[model samples]
Target: MSAGPTSFCGIELAHPIINASGTFDAIAARRAFGDAVVERFPFSAYVSKTITPAPRAGNPPPRLWEEPAAMVNSIGLPNKGAEGFLSTDLPALADLPVPLIVSVMATSAEEFSGLVEAVSARDEVAAIELNVSCPNVHSGLIVGEQPSETEALLEALRPLTAKPLIVKLTPNVAAPASVAAGAEAGGADAVSLINTLKARPMFAGKPWLGAGSGGLSGPAVRAVALQQVSDVAAAVSIPIAGMGGVESGSHARDLLDVGAEVVAVGTASFRDPLAAERILIELRGLDPVAASSATSEL
Candidate 1:
């Protein structure tokens, strides 16, 4: 019956509104909005940008190309690496009032486990979100596509860290629910999805993004996101953090109405940094129990 506040995987979030990992940057965001970022901080819990084991230069220039309603990005998860994040970026973001969900990706189970342990040791980190949806450079297969691979990855990474492990599922998979089931079976504390789909576009007779193909996100994928969230939520027992093309409070509620415990705002953040906050306010006005109960019966 309660709706003002909610807790996901034991982390008490002031509201269900949160940013999708790699979407909002609290550091750079502060420079633009100044005092406003500290005052409201759009997301209830800030999910850090995707961090890798080593430094990455990322894809070549022209990494982002704006489309009509959606944008294509092949940034390739560029970062200063985990060490830099832990030392420099993290300190800058540590003082924020909201919980921090660190997004991490690695090539193998061992590397993933190491990252989990390292990040888990940090007191500022509230949860560890594993980005297993990335199409591996070594194995053409995506980690989140196969249930066996997803389960194995989680099993290896879970034992190395005590912090809550939230696996980010891939929408490109055959059966999104089976992937979520794998995460739960492997002891994942929670699960989130669906990451952007692999997309390709040749804008005006030339390749748009440098990588040729990039993950597609924005309002264009809202329906796919809803279906994926509903499918995964039905298959898993753990809490589901659902997101994709959430642009409005009604869009956020649509995901929640499908069984998502929490909704993440992604592309919308770029259009309106205050979008998540607005959705939170709107969500507060709705009846959480009634909405969830109705969805469960479907």
Candidate 2:
């Protein structure tokens, strides 16, 4: 156990500070910081990068572009397929000092089910986070964009395993609360937000990212995240993992005030791999009891 330990979706976490799915790469960190980093890992829970049904080569060059207050990335969710992930990445992540949440994305409900079943079988994975950014083959709308679609997807995968399923919400939606309601009705253990907003930039008569459009993250999306987190919290009673431009404890406090049960450190980790520890210290300084209590219940 660690200081200010709490629970999320029945999993005991050392603290409320966890990494967003694709933000902090623990394997890379270990290579850079060695055993010391793993000995005092920053996050109470570790979320692995998103995995897909099939291997992805990723987008071409110019994958990441720095902006004024944030960054735009068109990395294209590149990763080894499910089998490769289970064989390679899973073993490497199992030894981390915190519960692990595996993130996955697919193009269809059946594909999503396959991913859910496969990842849930692993003992190291405490939960599964659906990166609902992939487009649905039938509706053509992104899974996270349509409330009905989200519910239907959840209904299909709910029985696949008993492991907790978390739906990662997209901020680029008209009614995030409604979608959250759907997830609750379909049996989601928790919900996280907001997956970067769609962004497109031009320079020298050319688009910035090779993929033409990218997702913008960092401080620029903090306000949007707060509004969305509050809306979803009001709509659903399940645990909420909130994040967006969380650079300090005050920023994280805002998310909790708006009803986020756990706060995930994302973009800021790019600048400081140990940013979560600093944020947690600051968050405790504000109201240690309140911060600990948020994730302590349910």
Candidate 3:
């Protein structure tokens, strides 16, 4: 069996498998592997690394700590700012075979509005994802952690553009569903979870990462991803792009069974750049519904 076409947020997708934000660097892969990476693009829709209003130096060294089936990262969303991305990276990414979804983060609604407006202006950008894990500069509250903040942010930015707005929910919250509901209520087209679990790895009784603590990812968070995805699905009527430690077709199937409209391959891509393709193939074998329901719809 072969994976059939699907749609997310009115955007046509070749398959339900897409890469999580910052996981697969399409440009880097193309530079390293040449056109082969582009010819066989792993994801149906490519999500760029999180871009901020200004350039970020990112965290210090010792940013990654590998556990048994997971890894902790304090990469700190390194990027060349929104203007740099629009000027330099956007041109290159526009050439990709798949649709591009730009992920943006900011500490305030004004900054977020600027990002959304700028990114959405580009014809090549198919959607915009809001990375809301950071603290708001005004209230000092993590927007994604609080339902009201999430809703208010979305409400402020909803009318900026007609493009789909996906709120990337943080898993640190006790009731992520409420936040998802808030996003949906405030005009989010969709919601994605779980971002990462807070972790402070230790080595020799000392903190391992330079940032002291980081977000945990990989197989260890699969169950948590499932639970949160299910919870958010029940709370919001919009679509979901579920991701955590998806490494196989069975894992993808598990997410779909729980309520994810699409599954994102993250840690698995670290091991194999073409992991999404394999997972899609395996997923076709496991779930015939994915193939039978090929019609495109929002």
Candidate 4:
């Protein structure tokens, strides 16, 4: 059996598999592996690393700690910022065979509006994903943790672009469903979840990461991803991109069964650069009919 095409927010994709933002760096991969990396690019749609208004130096190391079937990271979304990304990276990323979704973060609605306007103005960007994990500079409240904040942020950003706005929900909240509903009410075209669980790994009674606490990812967060995806699905009619510890075909299928329209490969890519391709092959083999059915619904 052969798999059919899938679409997210009006953008047609060859498959339902995509890369989690920040997990796969196409530019570095191309430098390491050359054109083969682009010739057989793994993800259906490529999501860029989180970008800010100004360049970020990122968090101090030790930034990573290995755990059983998981890893904690305090990478702090290092990027060359919006200007540098547009001037340097966007050209190379635009050359890839897949549509591009740019992930962005800001501390205020005003700042976020600027990012949306600038990024959407470029023809290379197929959509914009708002990374709502940070706190609002004015309210000092995490935008994704509170439904009101998420709704207000969406409302502020909705008018900036005709492109799809995907709200990347943080999993630390008590009820992610409410936040998802709020995003929908405020004009979000879709939502993606299970960004990573908060963790404080200790080494010799001292915090291992320089940031003290970091976000955990890998096979350890699969169950949490499913439950949150299920809850968010029930609360909104918008499409979903579910991810967290998805290392196999069965893991991807589980997220789809729960309600994710697309499954993003994260930590598995660190283990194998072509993990998304392997997982997509396995997914087609496991249940081509189910994959086809899900694509039809999308």
Q: Estimate each model's TM-score.
A: 0.92, 0.95, 0.96, 0.96
Q: How much does candidate 4 score in TM-score?
A: 0.96
Clashes of each: 0, 0, 0, 1
Instruction: Give the per-residue lDDT of model 4 (tens digit) for 27-114.
Output: 9999999999988898889999999999999999999999997999999989999999999999999999999999999999999999
Cα lDDT tens digits, model 1, 1-298, are 1334679999997667789987888898898778678777767788998999998889986777777878778889989999999999988888787899999999878778778888999999999999997655556677888888888888887778788999998888789899889889998999999898888788799887888888889988899999998888778889989898888777888988898888899988888888887776666557666345332111
lDDT of 3 by residue, 191-285 (tens): 98989899999999999999999999999999999999999989989999999999999899899889998899998999988888888878887
Q: What is the lDDT of residue 38 in candidate 2?
A: 81
Look at candidate 1 and tell me the lDDT of residue 99: 93
Residue 217 displacement in candidate 2 (angstroms): 0.4
Better of 1 and 4 by TM-score: 4
Q: How many angstroms is residue 57 displaced in model 3 relative to the true structure, after the best TM-score fit?
A: 0.9
**lDDT ranking, best first:** 4, 3, 2, 1
Report the backbone clash tally of model 3.
0
Which stretches of candidate 1 lie above 4 Å from their native place? Answer: 1-3, 135-140, 287-298
Worst ten-residue run, lDDT, model 2?
Answer: 289-298
TM-score of 3: 0.96
lDDT of 2 by residue, 98-123 (tens): 89999999999999999999999899
Clashing residue pairs, backbone N/CA/C < 3 A, model 2: none
Overall local distance difference test of candidate 4: 0.92
Instruction: Write down the lDDT of every candidate, Cα atoms only.
Output: 0.83, 0.89, 0.91, 0.92
